[model samples]
Target: MNKGFYFERNLLALSRFDPALCSRLSGAETTRGRYRFIESRSGESIPALVDNSGAAHPLHSLVDPRREGKRLISTLGNEGFLIIFGLGGGFHIEAALEKTTIEGITVIDFDIHGVAELLSSREYIGIFNDPRFRLLVDPSAEALEQYILDRYKPVICGGISLLPLRTRADFSQGLFNQAGEAIKSAIDMVSADYSVQAYFGKRWFSNIIRNIAQAEQNTVPLAPVHSVAICAAGPSLDAQIPLLAERKNRPFIIAADTALPALISAGLTPDAVVSIDCQHISYYHFMAGLPEQTLLFLDLASPPLVASRSPRPYFFSGGHPLTRYISRYWRPIPEVDTSGANVTYAALSLAEYLCARNIELYGADFSYPRGTSYARGTYIRSLFENKQNRCIPLEALHSAFLYRTPLFKQGDENNSWYYETKPMAMYRLRLEEKVRSMKARIVVVPGMGAPIRLETNTGDNRTADTLRLFSSGKAAMGALEFLAQYRAGINALPLLQGPVYSFLTGLSKEETIIFTTLLPAAAALKRSAPELDTPELFDAVKKYCVGELEKLLGIWGMR
Candidate 1:
């Protein structure tokens, strides 16, 4: 076939898959001297990159390029999202598309001109036509990271792996290296999130549905405060209590549920308390008795018992898929950032959402100082005391708790020393990262534990004049009505008949939203089963979600 015919056929095929990419290729001017087309031993046209040293390096084998492509793909595991660093000849991508176990494939390459040359030289229509394939040309690090974050769902796509064409990647080592780091960062976030979902997905769904009734109850709106203090149940809380109490009512105090007992025991009642844990163990934090006038800010996924503790709990969305769905379709609940994966972070988010101009973080030490885990009056201390006996003393139990995970020791033994586990360090790092983006001036109280590094902005710290309160807007319908509609939407979804990708692509906007809402639960289901294929997993999720909705509807009917 002529070069014109080859280019046209390829562009036509790509247009059916990615019209935007096709348009770019159509308009892209192919730069010469970068890559040259050569005939392989198999009589197939292959492109070879011309290096800066005046030498040409073939991306694929000179002989039997198709066989080489198959070999490269065979080396990778069957499950997960595949990220190809260099588009090369597109043979490996085509091979990857044929594997049903590989959920998705994204081709990342720089230079639109180089890509256009490849498109013009040979046919990539087969790879483009596959629903599983995606092409990102000359994407910025941030753009690449965001794309992976948005599309690479670990629950649905499984794990992620990268394949790089050595010759091509070597040409742009710095760019490819940056891309690798971006991919790693995105994967770490997704994996952590997926791990949480796998454990709490079912519980979050259950809690959210049950809390909908409590969330519907009208609560007093909190006026935005200029200054706020967030109390976390770190080891330093015991030492920080006197200073915290010294402030009195000067600043609005928002206590993490874990720190509520410590604050209460110190005769300091925070203005509000935030709780985001979906586990039943979160109930222990409130066993200290919630202050009567203290407002409760509970994540929609928190245990229902925790919500019941407050006279009128202020329910907010914690970025859960189902809660977001509820906010959009049923009620507009204020969203709080719980992405830090800790209650302390959630409290900070609440403070920020309240538009607090100056924020003080007390007991924010994200480490175990002097082998201490929590504040003196926190639930862990009391629980350990209750469990201790002659054989296992309180000190022994404390030591065991402190040494449960791998610990990294910091600080000088002569002054003050602390041990940090992987999770605690991660929490600190995330909070530090979050602080850099906040409009509020963050002040971390000096503590004996691991020091928090705050990179607050020097610019104006004031946020919007007015902030949104929890459950501010009226719902279009009642909880029961919303559930009924959601149930019907799930039932109305088109049956999965063919490839999962094809089925997903065919979903209407409304249908897609409904399906997206079920993803977290699907993650949990996949974690428990793992044997269920994509279609079977979808079927299972639909049945499970529908059952829960029906059960909830039945209970609501009696009420």
Candidate 2:
């Protein structure tokens, strides 16, 4: 029997497979090749064979699982076209494929020989055929990377999709080390090109009209509409989905492209979906039997797959003329400035565009209170279900690396905090601010036990009449703690002069309401009373209530 005819490995067999070693994986066999391959406990070969160069070990030109893992998780927030530079025998690719939100995976490993070895296996045939997984074979990492830049780069910066990371390396640490000088030269060449970012900006200009259209959408007269619920695998979602289900009658329902199957298995059906992913292989979940009304908003600059999508018209972003034209001639388009690039923001932006003033946020718990990700569902069940114990360390890295802890003395009640790591919170706040300032009487109400302040210049109204907590009593709260000392003294009285005089001193009646909420010197001496367990200060509370009412009135065209 010609042993040379037998291919050595399978990409889909499992992780932790070593071709040189034996494991419990059923029907697993060593290939007739002399190369090293990825190994699993079950002895399944991952088709990752390299010569006895021990090159799979870390090298100067090689990337490690940790760094690639970080990029993979970080881009999950964006959930669009995610491209990894080196295939590295699919370890990082496997890690990334684990994320549900990401629509596509483009493993651009330039080593043509390695890629050929990978695709030859029966297990890998599924990945090749899978819509969400794309495997590009080029001669070397550098060429493949350039091909990506020439190809995938524009798709990302048009605010349409994102090329999460573009790097140069051979998956074989030994091979990468041998090519260190070449890799260095390639890196220098790219870094020295100088016009890359500016070039991207120019290409992005082609999409500006959509940006303007989206900006104008804020002024559009909209009816009260329901939104899709975008959920993540975070454990906090476990608590929020029930509450979300209770209100499903209102919102049409959408989930992170990944969350779709999870929600469906949990007896839910989303009306639509959103993803910026470009690779043809990332469509597995989105293409699953969707709800009849399901509409997906795809980034226009995504891979050509977006242009070729079927059954339902996956609307391209409004920033693209093609997208705007389609929405104009054919049907209404879903183009809202999602809080950010991820599904969560996409859902929010779409909801806002639909004029759903009441947004009920659930399963948005980005925190791993229990240090676990993935709710109970079959979508991710294949990768993680049976291996939870083995996966806890990964989750631990995920929790620590992904979640930036609030800087505060541990256990201190004064340590106020929120998940600031998800910048989408700040983006949501900004969107609300824009909505409120508009003629539309819009109010965004989303909060946990803590108060999330909308940073606005309207605080100027409170600055004059508002009293500091320290001025009221010794119970100097976190504000005082933040200051480290009490110094409001006589200067504080002058700060209120503007609001106080405007409110009390012979100002016209019309002007009075505008400054009516400002507290006076006497109010500063008042007691600090707050609803128990709430963070609002009494003087702060009074001034806030008055300011909001006055602002509302102003919004209503009242004097």
Could you say which candidate leads in TM-score? Answer: 1
lDDT of 2 by residue, 1-559 (tens): 1222323334333222222211222233334342345544444443333446544432111335445555555554544446555654454556665554444556544444444444344244334434455555343656544544433321211112323223335334454443343434543443322233223322222222222222222222324443334555444555566766777365656566666666776776666666654344446554445665655555543444433343434443634333443344333445555324345556655555554434444454433333343455624443454445754854554455445644222122454233333344444454444534422222223322123233442322212211211011122133212111112111122222211212233444423322222222112222222122111222343344334334433454542
Tell me the tens digit of each residue's lDDT in model 1 across 298-364.
9999999999998789999999878888899888889999989999999989888888888888898
Q: What are the clashing pairs of model 1?
A: none
Q: Give the top-scoring candidate (lDDT).
A: 1
TM-score of every model versus the real structure: 0.94, 0.34
Task: Report the poorest 10 consecutive residues by lDDT, candidate 1.
Answer: 462-471
Clashes of each: 0, 29
How accurate locally is residue 433 in candidate 1, as Cα lDDT from 0 to 100?
85
After TM-score superposition, the amount by which residue 335's alpha carbon in candidate 2 deviates from its true location, in angstroms, is 4.0
Clashes of 1: 0
lDDT over C-alpha atoms for residue 539 of model 2: 39
